[model samples]
Target chain A: MLKYLFAAFLISICLIVGKALAHYIGFFPGSIYGMLLFAAILASNIFDEAAIGAAIAKIINIMPLVFLPVCVGVIQYGDLLQTSGWKIVAVGMSSTLSVMALVAFICAKILRDERCD
Target chain B: MNAVIEPIIFCICSIAIFFSWLQFHRKFPFALFNPLLLSVISVVLILFLLEIDYSRYMTGGEWISAFIEPGVVALGYPLYKQMHLISRLWRTLIGACCLASLCALTINVLFAKALGIDEWAIRSLATLNITTAIAMETSAEIGGSAALAAVAVMIAGFTGSAFGMLLMSVLKIKNMRAVGLAFGSASHALGAATIARTSMEASAYASTALILCAIVTAIVAPIYIPFLLSL
Candidate 1:
């Protein structure tokens, strides 16, 4: 129990610092900044991965749960969906598929050639 | 529902519905049966049918939603675990991720424009290829609706998870490394997890791509999206 709390405390601190840094940098969100800072700390060996292992696992496990409300927030945009649903679907499908194909094709060519050479 | 008890009711109901769907997805193991997508649909229908005000439901929903940013921050752990692998393939991985980020942004923006999508929706659409938390925040930062961005990310993730492998087979992308990178870069975590079931090596590559692509897109989308919007 204490371990979980400590891990949460560490992450919260990172988040607060990240938000503060984001206030000045103005490029990305504080959450993302927090993620980077945490990653850097972990990479630098300041804190053992085991310290936060349980907390990280638990948080990630419920990630989809956290996203539910925001997704349901789409209810607020019914008018937008009604007017442009098909266009949104079309753009999303085509772009996602094309990006996948492009990345796969290019990476395959390069990586395979490296193996052959 | 009593006014005092309503929020708790909605919150508990949401969790119950989500867990039920999660179990169902586990049994079926089908992409179309995604727990998150199913849970969202179920909740939306429940609210609509009951004529519950979205705001009222949100009083409880906000409690769960508050964890989203912290959840994203936790993603750092997985990325950190993969640093050794990433460092070995740094050149190829970084180059592919940057290209993937650029490609996804340009295509989404240009296609949306060609389809006559409004600027606001287009901004949300532009960040669809990344993870939800980052995508939502980035979208709002760039004058888009975070809600719409979440919707767009869902669409992208669903499309990739459901059709990614089929598309790869059709396109004849045989290399597993490429497969992993494509799924990670284009589809984010959902696609990566789905592909992870088949090949651990590919999953590793996919996970690396997922984080790298998110970082790349988060940085590039601010400047590049506006330029694409202008054109």
Candidate 2:
């Protein structure tokens, strides 16, 4: 239980750090930095996972649910979507598929080369 | 008094709906019942029909937002474990993600311009490849609609997960490593999770690609988008 508290405490610190960075950088997503910073701490062994691994996993599992509020904000864009919904979907779908195809093609080529080697 | 009541209602409604959907998802495991998507739909309907304001929904919503950063950071452990495999493909992975980010950003911007989309909406689309938290932040930074960014990211995730595998099979690509990287780069965490059940290595690569792609987008989009706008 103490370790679990520590895990939450550590994450709070990261969030605070992310907020601070936000003040300086115009486009910096402090949260991404927070995760990277925490990951660095974990990678460097500054934070011992044995203390809070299970707790963190359980917290992360509900990560999707956390975004529901933000997703619901889509309701605000009713006018925008009404006018350009299909166009935006077209762009999103095409771009998403484009990235997937490109990444997969590159990975497949690299893997095939590794096989040849 | 209503402030307190509203927040309480938001929490109760969100949690109750999310939990019930999660239970159902566990039993059926169907893609159609994606917990996040369903929760958003249910909550939106509740807010609209009950005449609850978005700000009130945000009161409880703020609690969930508070966890976004830490939750993403917690992913560090699995990523650390997967570091060895990731290192072997580091150069390839980096190259692939960089190109993927470039393509995703560029395509959206071009489409927006051609369609004469509102500049704000275009800004949201610019960072669609990043995680929802970061994407929303980036969208707000560039004067875009944060809500639209979140929605676009979800749409991208659902699209990739629903159609990605079919696309792969059509291409006749049999390697799990490639499959995982494609989904992760395109759809972020949801895609990564979907592929996780297939094989451990694939999931590891997926996680790696997910993190790397987000990092790359965070770094590249600000500089790239402005440059594109100038052009």
In order, the candidates keep a fraction of the true contacts of 0.83, 0.71
Best by TM-score: 1
Candidate-wise lDDT, in order: 0.88, 0.79
Q: Which whole-number lDDT from 0 to 100 does residue A97 have in model 1?
A: 95
For each candidate, what's the DockQ?
A: 0.78, 0.66
On the 0 to 100 scale, the lDDT of residue B227 in model 1 is 94
On residues B1-231, what C-alpha lDDT tens digit does candidate 1 reach at each position? 587698788889999999999889879988788888899899999999999888988999998888888877888887887898787888899999999999999999998899888998899879899888889888988999887898898888889999999999999999999999999999998899889898988898899998999989989999999999887
Q: What interface RMSD, in Å and to 1 decimal, does model 1 have?
A: 1.2
Question: What's the residue-level lDDT of B169 in candidate 1?
Answer: 99
> What digit string (tens of lDDT, one per residue) describes model 2 on residues B34-153?
888888888888889989788878998877666666666666655666567667777788888898889889988987788888777898877776667667766776678778998888
- Best candidate according to DockQ: 1
* Candidate with best lDDT: 1
TM-score of each: 0.95, 0.92
Off by over 4 Å in 1: A113-117, B1-3
- Return the TM-score for chain B, candidate 1: 0.95
